[model samples]
Target chain A: MNPSNNNIETQDDIGTTGHEWDGITELNYPCPRWWVWIFLGTIVWAVGYWYIYPAWPVISGDSERGGTKGVMEWTQYKQLEESQSEIFSRRAENLEKLQNTSTKDVMDMPELYEFAVVGGKSAFKENCAQCHGSGGGGAKGYPNLNDDDWLWGGSLKELSKTIKYGIRSDHKNTRNSVMPPLAAVMGKDSVTKVSRYVAGLSKGSSSTAEGAKEYKQMCSACHGVNGEGNRIFGAPKLSDGIWLYGKGDEQQIESQIKSPQHGVMPAWIDRLGEDTIKQLVVYVYSLGGGE
Target chain B: MLEKHKKLEKNSILLLIFIIITISIGGLIEIVPLFRLETTIEPVKGIRPYTPLELAGQDVYIREGCYGCHSQQIRALRDEVERYGHYSLAAESMYDHPFQWGSKRTGPDLARVGGKYSDSWHVQHMINPQEYVPESIMPSYSHMATSKASLDDIGSHLEALRVTGVPYTDSMIENAYTDAMAQANEGEANTKDGLLKRYGKNTIVRDFDGKAGFVSELDAIISYLQVLGTMADLKDYNPDVVE
Candidate 1:
């Protein structure tokens, strides 16, 4: 059979392209009417969307007129602004109360105290939980908020002050102190004897005569005579079980005495603002550690 | 129209050519706007190029796949702004050859982490993330502290970055190794002064790893992490104006 003759006719009485393989004919069918209408509808919707949003770029390249400015004048930033404004307006009264009231007096009002605690809890999670544990259990150097040991006094007022200015931060009002590496100043052997004496001070064990003599000469100025610790110096009471840097072990104490790693807490005043700080102060004070 | 369609479908080479043209239209629409990228990024002050040490740290960050868990880009949302300070600007990542504007955030955003914590805190967090943050699922990178940072190839690294439109000066490229060493060991008067002279007075010159003498990978990575979103000063930017 001639290849040209195969395109002449088909067995079935239907429209065909005359393209057949092994006597199988092909029929050309139009697209479904509903599907075609829906497709057209989508194109119309797309065009309408283009007109209603920043869509097609213009040739001019000017940002203002670069793309089609919809009548809505909407942006992601604008949406965020609106939502934030709504939130601020809703909490305006409570926020004002939080700002005006003293951190210590905040606990007097039940509702305000609850609000502050809730706010502070979230703020703590975002800001404080990174260095301090999620439960405020404190890290190796970072202070534990749940313990009764006071590094820089655990009172609500003191907590507020510490949180505001921070300890050894760049903030001018920061609670500044320097625990000089005693090894450099008092010789290595004295530091060891002093470490042993300081470790024994909290454990109800009496220091050796040699250790006691060394402690008075080098450590009494900041740590106090009996290792009671001075708040002004930001020194910890050596008699307590709470060790800021490590587990109150002999080696850890010796290492600390050799080269003290002064813990630095950033002043949250610039970052978190006063109201949040007050709330954080109240929350931290309520954590069973406040003096 | 039917005959034309039938003829077009029958010709494979013609169909291929038409397909190419159709796809090219989409490709051009997507790619052409990048040619005018300068217009896209807002003008912001204090967005300087990364110092050699920070650049090396950034290389370490990329190598360790830190971007897999953390995102650098903070969207202009109320919650994000409240938590992560200001929203990230395109100008901040302008000098980055392949920017670290990651999408996922398994860990917190590192956009404004600089100056939030001290160098020792970063060192501790890097060595064992769970030590400070007990709930943290991040893996320990204790090995980074022990590993010494290779400073010999730092000059070449600066040259490579300079080729990708980073404004690294001839002197900066030449003194990249020393500058990195100086930034890590700020106690050394000569190197510290040299670093300040080359990188600018604002350069953070200190032992980032808390270990005074030796420069380690931990130091480089901590430097990079610390300076994540601190470069671009967004003080004058009024978000309301854009809105």
Candidate 2:
């Protein structure tokens, strides 16, 4: 090593500290080289990222040139639209046929039946499932669509009629018969006798004298002479043990005969198309009673 | 004074930013429509809608606010299965616009209650709530038992409902002809064809005996009641594989 006169011949092992603090202490040190590189890279990437996506709140409308449209211009709303379209395409073919075909033709297509089943389940959920459960099972006063016993006939045709022309609703051309209030027609006391006699019908017992006459004139019109229910009227068989609201004990029957009952189903023609209703009929029919 | 105040402001500003960011994250998570799973069923499956009359009964149920006490859905709990039936399937309420998974257990669930009672029974119960069940919280809807309807419409209106998605077909529309004949027998001259043209050919009526005309909207409503919970096809609907 050279003596103090030659500057290039210095032999210090460590690098220089730009500033000296208090004699021998040093103040400066370079950060690690890798760290410096990464830091710079991140800053650069951020600038590019900001340019590409809508990372910032947008204030401009569609007219701005470079005012918005963060380079890619992608949006969640658009992504949702695209995904929905993809799902819709799978349904489109079936739905198209449905919209075009008459419901009768729709029924003939067993494959369409399969499609209808799939479609009907969801439609039923949206349209009929509120009163009828997801599976067409009903509640205390509500009738189950999945059962073999139908107040109305269980045939697809019969089911369809019921759906199209709802009962007791304000719908135009609604199904019409009204149970005259027994109290309205028969004096209050007669109601008791009639209800009891009507109760006897379920047991296949003869109606009391007053009941026999009232049954012939009033009840037999819908309930049938033998007390078997008219599926057409949706009147239940008197004999069946299955009670919707309750069974025909003396008071129960008296209350019923005194006042005819009203149950209501909303119309679905405008809500669910005819084919879908038919499909629901098929689905319901397929559930318990096909015969 | 300016320097001291600026220092204080800086400290508060940083605190505010941290709080805002934390709250924003929490808000976002809560806003998401957290999808939950109960049971599994294919999204697009088929089953029949209730008939017009049966559908009418459902309308009656709703009109009377039966949904308040009775739920059509049976939960997956053991008590529900025992009290109602098998667990209420998602498939059961698929067609319902507003599912009737009742909020309370005031009355038993009627998920599978169609044909569970005779028409007269329903009639009686509606007339006097306590007549059948010694202890019932329901108020008798005796008004429904009479022709004095709180609401109207049973056929064409149902056609409108059919548009909602309960399933109607052309043959069913033709049945309107037989239905019209039945209506005639019931003392109305309207033919199914005439009704069909107006309600559109898809109108469905379940009164197979063609005794439709005599059926007031009330009869139709009762018909709706008659068809509840009848969809028990173990073969078509294999419970084991429904999921």
Global Cα lDDT for candidate 2: 0.58
Write candidate 1's Cα lDDT for A89-108 as tens digits: 98889999888887777889
Give the proportion of true interface contacts each model preserves, from 0 to 1: 0.60, 0.00
Candidate 2 residue-wise lDDT, B50-163, digit = tens: 443445556667777788888777655544443344455565675554566788768767776654444445565666756545457778776654442222344564466568
Error of 1 at A149 (Å): 1.8
lDDT of 2 by residue, A29-50 (tens): 5798999999999999988988
| Ten contiguous residues minimizing lDDT sum, candidate 2 chain A | A58-67
**Looking at candidate 1, what is the lDDT of residue B14?**
94
Q: Best lDDT goes to which candidate? A: 1
- Listed in order, each prediction's TM-score against the native is 0.89, 0.44
How high is the lDDT of residue B68 in model 1?
98
TM-score of 1: 0.89
Taking the tens digit of each residue's C-alpha lDDT, what string does model 1 give over B1-243? 767877779999998999999999999999886666565567677888888889889888888999998988889899898788888988899988789889999998887888788788888887787777777899989899999886779899889988989999998988888889888884345877777887677788778898877889999988887777877767787643431
**Residue range with the least summed lDDT across 10 consecutive positions in model 1 chain B:** B234-243
